[model samples]
Target chain A: MDDLWYSEYHTPHVRFSVKVSRQLHYEESKYQKISVFESPEFGRFLTLDGIMMLTERDEFIYHEVITHTAMAVNPEIKNILVIGAGDGGVVRELGKYQGIESIDVVEIDERVVEVCKEFLPQTSCGFEDERVHLHYQDGLKFVRHTDNLYDLIIVDSTDPFGPGEVLFTKEFYGNCYRALTEQGVLINQHESPFYEEDAKAMKSAHRRISHAFPMSFVYQAHIPTYPSGHWLFGFASKSLHPQRDLKADAWNALEIKTKYYNTELHQGAFGLPNYVKEMLKDE
Target chain B: MDDLWYSEYHTPHVRFSVKVSRQLHYEESKYQKISVFESPEFGRFLTLDGIMMLTERDEFIYHEVITHTAMAVNPEIKNILVIGAGDGGVVRELGKYQGIESIDVVEIDERVVEVCKEFLPQTSCGFEDERVHLHYQDGLKFVRHTDNLYDLIIVDSTDPFGPGEVLFTKEFYGNCYRALTEQGVLINQHESPFYEEDAKAMKSAHRRISHAFPMSFVYQAHIPTYPSGHWLFGFASKSLHPQRDLKADAWNALEIKTKYYNTELHQGAFGLPNYVKEMLKDE
Candidate 1:
């Protein structure tokens, strides 16, 4: 139609707008509203509840950082359970490692997968692999019910609002802890630290995850589509510390090519600013 | 005034906007259009030619990354030459170390310094320091004419466009190399790599700096007020390698309290992503 612009409220006083050439697709999914847009700069991008989920130009940074940080920490990790990664970006990155035997993706809404597979094949292409098992259900329930323990569990959920609210709670994190193997690692989409609401959510999630796992730390990546362009990921493990247990040589031996994640960056990402360090403190 | 929103074009198709409380000040300097705004989210911010220079909330990330990276690399740095840092953020950060004997700040436009002092004292406080010497003249000319040698040279100029364009050329970089002491370190504001225009500038600056100095590298910081929040800084020196010469223990001994720059991050910031590494490669 006309030159349409979509704006998202990064905070009450800040807004990020992208000029859309056209709306590629739009659907009211069971859990949230999913929309795909075509833009000249960012290429094609998907959004949930009017918030940017991933852009073709920058999704590699997010997915690679989230999936490979834990994988590099524990290269022997075979079984992976991804919750709320309906966009399939997380699973796509995990599929690169031949060592990963099984990948179980639990998405609350099936519509997201359907739309992504139709409109965003670059990310959804991983679903075609035989090792991936898609479970259409609530991730909170799936974690509680699954008797099979996982070597790694990735909470790739959306912002801590609407459909993704429960995933950031203490009960959900507790279930994730119980669902992990002896040396299991849990990585979650920790919120941004720039805005008030996001900082509050980031602190809450860190407190709960830190309580559940003996070791929990936060790392960051530059995701331009996100609120502050700075997005954080939580790394929690039973006995393996992200930095101390880091198998750098082992991960590098895999030769899995990545756009953003590297062994040095893996350790460096945990070197956060002093203010963010104060925000995630145990108090 | 009424409710007003400030918008900056990230790229041709992407826009970043903030709701402005009001325009603190605006002037058409001989070089460019300089404006200041008070925002609820980012606090007071300055703009040159409708592009964000820095914000009160996030200027620490930019200033810290640029100044402390070299300081940590060579803790004995006694004299510094700063070009085009009219806002005074870089000088303020450099003022922290007692070892820093003299700081010469060169600015093409005195209006930027005047406005920031009047409206943004948090960053402009460094101007009051007795050790800081301000020169209201072109940075390119300042570097070429100065017979004085400095241990550190900081090129905190705006994007490589319009008035700030000449500072990114090879001739200017050669002058920076000549104007430095034997163990001198030079840091320049290399633009982001996400947008096409910015990526071009980043590559151009890197190539020139690499040509001038024997050891040249690029580092990044997350500045949300900028185009993509992913900003790069160029580090070049004659004999000092940023990582190899990094005196983490020495820098930490100074005990300078900062919100963003720390020794660990100083090392981590140099860990460039693979994509960025590819971009900076000598083709």
Candidate 2:
């Protein structure tokens, strides 16, 4: 590899590139193309279908934020169902909680799990926990078939396009709503609010999620590796306001240390800027 | 002229690029290089010394958050001193408040202001206000000579390498502390914490500011064009907590139609992630 560089077009006119040391692994799975690259600054990163999924250096920010944010809101949450989190980063974060009884992960392609388990043990190590169950199937069908089982449903899917397009539909969100317990919480990887395609996806997901769950809300985190370095997440719950119902004291008592997620930041994350609020509210 | 793409290396290994339609203007100022570009997605943007300053698209987030965040903390802030904001964006935001009596902007390079005033009136129009007085001199000397004059001091300087390096030193911070009134607030463009070069600057600035002001704090905002898309700002005051002192109702009643800054976000912006908090505290 002579000065190998990987570039992703954030928009038609905007591009972000990384200087790669070399390609560690590349393979075509049943669902998408997965590749691992060794980079100097970002460390080793995994990409799916030419889109960035996780990098070893910054993956903790995304995984810890998504998992601990919900756990802090409802400390009693025992059962968690993660969809499309084949990298096992979300499951790895969930395993930190002693109270979580069942960690069910539904990944469409088993190859993603196998690749991660081999190359990315930092996250895939969660699979060793006795509570985790890897279900190799489609998440859309899994949620539609089940009812009132999970306390939390985490949709950690890829970008809302191609094979992952079905995950953003209103029908899929309705099924997630039905698949959750009374005090259920559904958190998804809402797309970026920048760029045309990402903004379109973000708006659509928020609209669909709002239709299924009346208590849908959005939060932001700065994941520098993402499209805009600014990313949003959808938090839909039955009757919990993330800020108002935050179990800060209770969560603090648990002493679950985190790099990104904190009680003060949990309240702050929900404080969307006026522009993003207008975008989400405009429907 | 043909397929022109402007790329800024965020780190040696990480690069961010935009497809440029054309170069609007290019010149060598007495201090550094100044250039402007027109891009499809980012609109028109300015760069000095091969580093991005601001773009028409997302400039509001930077200007608004920097200006309004401090204003909400102290609604009575009438005198402001801005350093190195040659683009006039800070002055434009400062002019929004009728109570602000004086805005003294110090830019070492006068050509940067002339270029922006000619080609970037969206921000440079701020020079129209009678209260704004531009002093084309060193900000370090200006602060050193003045004492107890400004109610707020905003250092919107470039990165801490070139001529702007003096602004991050303890002596300069001590000068800024002395150049403020009793209820003074000092804010500066602290660098990012991800990359090594940026993290070094951020830590240095925080360390220097803490030595001058007891109430030194750091806040974050998502400005995607900058390095790593995770930008930090320093807020040092005599006796004020950004979140606790935020006059949300007072600021809201003013009916300021802002695109990014909001009362809720003002409180939230100061809630740093644990890692960043640990980084700042580590020094």
- Top model by DockQ, which number? 2
- Give lDDT tens digits, candidate 1, residues B1-283: 4679999888878888899999988889888998999988889999999989999989999999999999998989999999999998999899989989999999999999999999999999989889999999988999999999999999999888898998998899999999999999999989998889999888988888889999998888888888888889999999999888899998899998888888887778888888888898852
Give the C-alpha lDDT of model 1.
0.90
DockQ of 2: 0.87
User: What tens-digit string does per-residue lDDT give for candidate 2 at A141-231?
Assistant: 9888875489999999999887788899988998888888888999999988877789889998999899898799999999999998999
- What TM-score would chain B of candidate 2 score versus the native chain B? 0.98
lDDT score of residue A237 within candidate 1: 89
Isolated chain A: TM-score per model? Answer: 0.98, 0.98
- Cα lDDT tens digits, model 2, B116-190, are 988899999989999998999999999888754888999999998898988888899999988888889999999
